[model samples]
Target: MTTALPSGLASAGLNAGEQELLDRVGQVARACAERADHYDRTARFPADDFDDLFAAGLNAPTVPREHGGLGLGPLSRDTLTLWLVTKELAKADLSLGRCWEGHANALVLVDALGSAEQKRRWFDGVVTRGEKWVGWSGEPQAPKPGEKRRFGTSVVRDDGAWVVTGTKVFATSATGAQWAILLVDTEGPGGARHAPDGRDSLLMLACDLSDPSVSVDDSWWDPIGMRATVSHLVRFDGTRLPDANVIGAPGAYLREGWQTAFIPHYAASFLGAAEAAYEYALKYVIRQDKVADPYVQHRVGSMAVDVESAYLWLRHVATLWDTGKREEARLAGSRARHVVEHLALRTVDNCVRVCGARSLIRPSPVERILRDLTFYVRHDNDDQVLATIGRALLGQEHDASFYKP
Candidate 1:
């Protein structure tokens, strides 16, 4: 609604073709919102939604045409395009928007780090063939007591092949996907997996979900929000992956390259969620004509300010993507995520107060938006990001490492 739209966000990073493709994606997602709950209620995958995205050729923007995609090169190409697209889809339905996050991560991996054969072999599957998968963030085996510090899966080299045995608890899209980019234990006797000191390692594996070595047992996914996301346990027995499936050798998984490269792709979903809350609140209050009252106007104005701030912060972060600052992106990612999501909840809560219990009704548009925003605001992973920023301000590497990329 504001001409203040981050200027050139579309043209600078995308071609005319890509812009057209993004428009088509937005249209299709708008149409599919009606059916999102049908799948959500049944705990079924949103196949028709995926079909719509695939038909629109919007599976992953980062994959190259040589591999059968738009070749947009991650969030860097058209940051606003990626931001708007993900937010619009999420407004329609979070589960569908969320599944795309995994696909985007995989695409970034294939484009940024995949070997030539990987591009040759699985590139088309991602773009042209519509191969979809989820990243393994929360999935972990039962870490012995407090061993949650380690990602439970293990990838041990056996002769020329790799054998993987572990369980991914609460793995999203557990039975529906053909591949998973799982984290694994690659620390050797030295325990130096990352710079400075850390015993943990990250491993990204392209595994066969169809093999008997993989079993999806006990779908323990009763949640107050993000329902219909059938996040369950996926167990990997003594399964063998061709050594080629290992990404970036044995020890490079947790470094700045792999982690930072694909991290922001998941964040589009969070930004989208927060935006949904803001948009839903704004529309509800205006439609109800609640703004006529002086108190209501003041409250509505506050919410508008919050909405503007969230998008403004988002576009600022988008600017970072425009500049291609990959190595120093960690703290920026954390701060942007926290700020946008915070504004989302604050905006939604204000709107809910303005709308009263009507906002809390079953399937109330604002109610669902509020729930989604709450969950979005809570996705804090490693607590080191804020700590790192604080340390950098004090010029103390002993406290943390900071990147300026």
Candidate 2:
């Protein structure tokens, strides 16, 4: 028998079209889960899984209908549906879900900030052609030994074209992505070498990853879990693009609050990973005839509670976004992220504890799930997120400003 969705998610607020999309996502997720082990074992990119997603019309749901997409507009009830889709996918395969989230984030930005021509180009390449898209924004390298550390990749205007030069670590799904929306600084050769306000000059560049100037370094991505994601280091050396390739104005990427709008997606993905571990433990315990033990029951009960709480928190964050409670939604997103992160970690731990040492061996789904969940929840700015929440709660600063990128 097919498992029933949680009560909270069974009746989640979704329109007819959104429900249809969720069903499609669920189908693809199940298929992805069936092959997740092989992909993990080989540490290879799940290209076939993405092909299944694309064939199911699940590649670019956030693009507007006018641009040939599912037209799930920003900050709408559809956002909740999208979160459900990501959660289901993550439950099946966290690495694929990570790549999907990046794709969704890219579409969100394109829909919000792209000009008419830019949107048409992106829609044709991604939505129509079924090409995969990813986002690369994280950077921790400096251009020179003495220069102040650069905050992001750099782009310089050169002879009517833009030359992007920098290296980005953790370029999730970089190996498979056909296009990337890169965060760049345009203030100077390498973005205001020592300026105090250089961070505010961030810009978004939509680059074709097939360009010769782009190179992928896969040597740095040997992780404990989510190994299939292939989030390697990527270098852009004199990667030239026309001025039209720039997606938004300088600082537009941050000013639009896109990051805050999509925070629930991340929470949903992590929650799904935890749920996967919990379900694995449930099945293992039942098969081993240990479900009747009081200790086993207690652990299972706690896992269920944690999973449900995380789902509810994700729903709350989605509701806040839908209701136009922008500031409150931002603050709530941060709080929910922290809560879900803790709950997910605990849920995985409980699952491992209940299942015992045998579950930690090879060919055991629980072991892999635990590793994936542990690595996935280590998102940046954990302590800073809590500090921001504290500041907002104490009225020391405006809540919305705390989530500015």
Query: What tens-digit string does per-residue lDDT give for candidate 2 at 194-257?
Result: 2223256776788899999999988867899989888887888899988798887776655655
For every candidate in turn, the CA RMSD to the true structure comes to 4.4, 3.6
| Number of the predicted model whose lDDT against the real structure is largest | 2
Candidate 1 local lDDT, 1-405, one digit each (tens): 432224653335556765777678779887767876575567666777877787877876667665566655434455556666776687777777766666666667656667998777777676666777766646332355645334345668788877777665546667566777765655421112222333235556778678888887644565555554567766778888877887665445444445554344445665555555555656766777765688767766776676566566556666676787654454565566656655666666777777788767866655655665565444443355566566666787622221321
Each model's lDDT comes to 0.61, 0.77
lDDT of 2 at 238: 90
